[model samples]
Target chain A: MATKLARRRSKAAAFGVFNPNHVVGGRVAGLIVAFWTAIALLLWIASPWKTLPTPPEVIHALHDLWWNDGLGPELFTTLKLIFHATLITTVLALGLAYLTVVPAMRPLVQAASKLRFLGITGLVFPLTLLTGGGYALKVALLTFGMASFFVTSMAETVLEIPRSEFDHMRVLGASELLIVWEVVVRGTLDRALEVLRQNVAIGWSMITMVEGISRAEGGIGALILNENKHFRLEDVYALLLVILLVGLGIDALVGLLRAVLCPHARLGKVRR
Target chain B: MIPGASVGEVVLDVKEVGLTLEEHLILDGVTFQVKDRIREGITTGQVVALLGPSGVGKTRLLRIIAGLDAPDSGTVRGLQGEELPAGTVGVVFQDYPLLRHRTVESNLLLAGSIGGLSAARSEARTQELLKTFGMEDRAGFYPGQLSGGQKQRVAIAQQLVVPRRFLLLDEPFSGLDPAALEDVSKLICEVANLDEFNTVMIVTHDIRAAMAVSDTLYMLGRASKNGKHVPGAKIVGEYDLVDRGLAWQKGIMERPDFVALEHELRGLFRTL
Candidate 1:
């Protein structure tokens, strides 16, 4: 009987990471940071860096950049860019979602959304070919590309909304505009935010790429590109530090918004 | 379409209305009408329910009535001599789709807010609903944080926020078990008789739920087959259930009338 009891418990315990203990471990706040830190350190060590300045030197360089090279204006520019991107993406995505799910336009929206995805993907390549060598043009192209995704993912999220929620909102006698504002917008906010957050990192890289190609002036992206092109190892490390700190700050902001706008609720068990 | 039509003037008129979805005939040749008047104390209310098995279009009927869906073959007429503009038909749908992002307070504030009522006015109405529903304590909580029952409570609160007589409820009691069902049933009864404008229409297969709160009940069938550009689905029967008083349906659901009603409803069609 005791052996049977142990055997019954064995399979239950055998499942990895789904054990209750693992659930508790997963919920710990900084577990992800710890895991990523270990991986990042491993990558840093495995990759060549002797000739490159160390992390501390990079930090000092970031401070110097802030103090001497003027971090404030560039930071403001990046912030402004993101804010505009977010706003434009939100309004356009909302309209696209509403149009996409309407039963009459459901098929057309479905077809159009598919076309838009292809169109947006096509847009990305042309930006590479046409916007040949201007950082400002590249920024515009990248922002446009980012907005296209906002429309796609957001519209998809909007389209995939549980039919049940849509029906309930209608039963509540919510106007079409009201449905867009309240139901569709709220339902898609978390997902749109996730896409926004994901693309933010991508945006950073894109900026650096533009700077590398276009020789733009003064932002951290430009700083990174400038340091690397000129072979200034110290400045490269300093710029990397700037990138790291800024990335973390943006990630933290995303987390704050998630908590404020998408925190766990009882129904979160069912829908995101 | 006069601005303020009176009793028997047809708040909702469905004439030979038929609906089709993905080649499935959900409702066919369905026709019905209701007045705009809430029942009062010491009097039977103008509460109506649509009862039928799943896929029978009990909800489709409600949707047509609520103007959430336009009938493929017919038109819907609203209380003020035209179909009340969308969002004008206060409803409590089966799933209790509360805005998960909003607080219980916000969930309850929907109608009043959309009606352009003042913040203070809507707040007061929300307060009244919260107090009545015993969810005043959860006012600040998001739907994601609330239990299934709590979400339904908020949904109910949303439907009741406006002082309109018209309503469309779809399987409002199916999600709740016996005890909370009792509480919700009682609350719905109280709301139905709140003396605003009037008629309450519900769609539910649970006869006991129908008999408990409805003044009259209609039964739609599973898969109507009218066979037109739109196939046919139809309302099989309409019933008057107002004779049963508040005390009649109290604790015991196994009573003769209850059992008979259940048997009668089950006899209607397939389990859908």
Candidate 2:
């Protein structure tokens, strides 16, 4: 009797009508339906003149802009800026976090934590003096903007590491550099990636502001300014969609990277 | 080096080590030495216990010995030098801080790689230690999945996966039931018996557990005098468990000599 019931369930599953495991729970499915429905209704209401960009029109504009209007290079430039800024921020944050572990350098870390309230946008003109308003200025702005938060998060991550792990590494006669690599880096890589993921979004959000202020050529921010100047609302929507899609893509890539780098996290073994 | 060194010979001399943190002394003028021992032509390592009450600097002293912490005024010399050679000391921390990012097998493999062992040798040794610790079935399990006793066993086995002349176990008997404690004690004795670990120091508050597997015992304590707080830990007592050979045999805890030693250690703690 049990064998017959199991066979029936398998047959039902094969037909796609009675899957024992649903793709989403009932509540989640309902929420997703409600969310998309609300979006559709909002789009309809906002398109009284039927110019709020249908999906096909947006896709067509995206294709035309990406292929002919230099959108690809501008997009790449913005991404490159974010990428380099995140890299520099990570290295600086890690160095700062390492220093905080030293008793003598703890005061420095406390000072850095307090500087988080200083706005990077406010530093635009001051930093332009140090770096003559090009890639360096923009990169510097983003890195400085994100650095304090990254350092604080990374330092907390470092502290959350059980001291015993560091002791264990030292007992193995590991050199200072080796301990940094084997214990600190490996122990905190998962959370560090998380910090980067969160900080990169903030960096991206500020990218357009910096680029617009600098009037940088060949960037999404410049492109947005150009579109806004011409009153091409459809093209503006298309560019906004491009930015949204790119941000979501980066997020997905980071999630995949995290999964590969820290499989233990997927197993729910990470303490936080 | 010794004039004519035997196998498993390691000499440790800790001289007048002092450390102060934030105006509170943790270890002041602490000194001890472990001489090489030869028993019937077999060079046996000395398993010593750093016993003290809670809040004393037993773990701090162990950290100093492991080269994890710097002493304010003294030096720890092993193998007749200022420093212990790489991969000569392996520590099992009080919390058994196994790598959360790796499984049991991967943790051992990581230690092996850090010690610069060849991959084949590391793989072979990891398997051997896993089997020895009765964790053959748990090689793929993460540390978070293990019970307290299993985590302790894996922690010890992870260290043994690499070659080391000294093994330091901090509070190995903590959070164990009576049966688990006995089992872990036997495991420690077996590891200390191996020729690789020429010196073993266990920092523990459980006097009976410490006495069970250690061949020598040292006590650290803090005392107040003249209405002033005494800074740092001081060596209070030393006992040679080697002189009581029969106490090391099975059911030694039930024996009168073991009971008497326990009472004496308790009395010593009371005085502190």
Candidate 3:
């Protein structure tokens, strides 16, 4: 039994380490992750830069921000802003994407998709002038910044749908309007959610830049910028960690919602 | 014709349908007609097979028949001799495209509703189809959760939820094991028997399986002029399996005559 077990272990190690397409077992994968994480920690600890905050300092800074500073409220403010912007962007992007089925709408959809290449900095002046430069401006800027990306992804999804799908609906005697609703609206809803998830991350990254324009709003972005201005490196690090955790939480939540609402999305994917 | 089956009015008439793509002629004057088969005061559905080599424009012709695409010349007329409208004929693509986000039951219900059934009626039909397709337990499952055969079944059931007279299947026998092949063949027959006017046109290269299930066989190939090959695909051969006493028979594939015909068709298919 001992010899058999040893042989199996050797064989697994041989395949797992060098085979091009061989997938490692769960335990081995977990070990690899732990090994890499430990190496990164060691490298960080042994860094030559004296200005870099130690792990303990970063942790203490996080605690201080949670208790002394208004991190919780600032996070809530950012979350609320993201929620509103995401809702508006979703409706606009989906509408524009679905309209591509119309011959006239194709050019407009193409124009909207191309808008992503335009820098948001160039549009901020016009956006501020239009919105009177306040909280509304920040929301407008975020929405403008994210809308093109969302539309691009969704339009591609809409286009990638095979011609057979529409034919399938038509054969069922579906009216033109019904085909749009069934194939475009409902058929791609799950993919829309996925696109939303990706765009939300992009929006989150841009929140700080947008909030910097409206410091009175007091979002996490503003807080991070203010800390950076003071040269409080540890606090900045803590704030960044907070942002990472919050973003991950939001991503996971949206993914979970997709699984619940569109459970079919995860089917046929390789599960660990 | 089969002993008790009588051919009736032409249900589908294709006249000189032709298509060209990017300076290349794909289909040249493809013409055929499908007539209703009546037996014992019931309209038993007809199964027609379209055989062709790869890239012989078989799928393009099928798309034209399904009204998903228009031919550059000629017309396809339905039962009333009117131009076939998009969605008038059902199509099952080779990949069995289903709305990935929807459950099997929802997919069927959507098709039924689009076909003009009321919500309650659609629900009732969905249930009946799920039961009939032996997918009652899997009605809650999504397309991605199904095996290839199961997905094919759901795809077929999706079309049947609506009262479609003509159905087009593209490569239904492609990529199936022996057992799965037999199962799909049986399912195709069952689909045909469900309604008298329900006609199935299968676009495939699998001669044996096509011959096993289809009552009529049409071969698409480039015609030869003066011993030289022509550029476009056209219907080169037509066989009435019913008149030949080979269609709708149990264990027919094992018979000597069937084997001989299969061998002969195999030789002909290689030339195309």
Local distance difference test scores for all models? 0.66, 0.80, 0.88
TM-score of each: 0.74, 0.73, 0.90
Per-residue CA lDDT of model 2 for A57-153, tens digit only, reads 7778888888989898999989998899989998998889877667798888878877789887678889999998888898999898888898888
Off by over 4 Å in 2: A1-165, A214-218, A226-239, A266-272, B1-46, B70-87, B98-123, B136-148, B222-233, B239-246, B256-264
lDDT tens readout by residue for model 1, B110-225? 76777667989999988998998889899998877778788777887787786766767667787678898878777777776666446667677677777776656677764424
Residue-level lDDT of model 1, residues A1-272, one tens digit each, is 99999987665544533544343233442665687889987786566857866666666877877788777787666566555655655565556666765678667545544654553345555676776635445565556656555556666778678877776666666666778777777766777677777766666556565445444545566666766778878777776666678877987797678667776422454311
The fnat scores of all predictions, in order, read 0.65, 0.69, 0.81
Candidate 3 lDDT over residue span B1-272, tens digit each: 56787788898899999999998999999998888877775557999999998899999998888887899998999888988777778889999988877889989988876777899999999999999889999988888888999999999999888788888999999999999999999999889888888899899999999999998899999976687768889888999888888988899999998999999999988777
lDDT of 2 by residue, B1-272 (tens): 22233323347888898989889989888888776655664546667888998888887787778767778888888876658543567788878887788899998998888778899999999999998999999999988788889988998888888766678888888888999888988887778778733677889899988888877788888776885547788887778776655334677778897899899999888666
Candidate of highest TM-score: 3
- lDDT of model 2 at residue A96? 90
> lDDT score, residue B226, model 3?
84
Worst 10 residues of 2 chain B by lDDT: B1-10
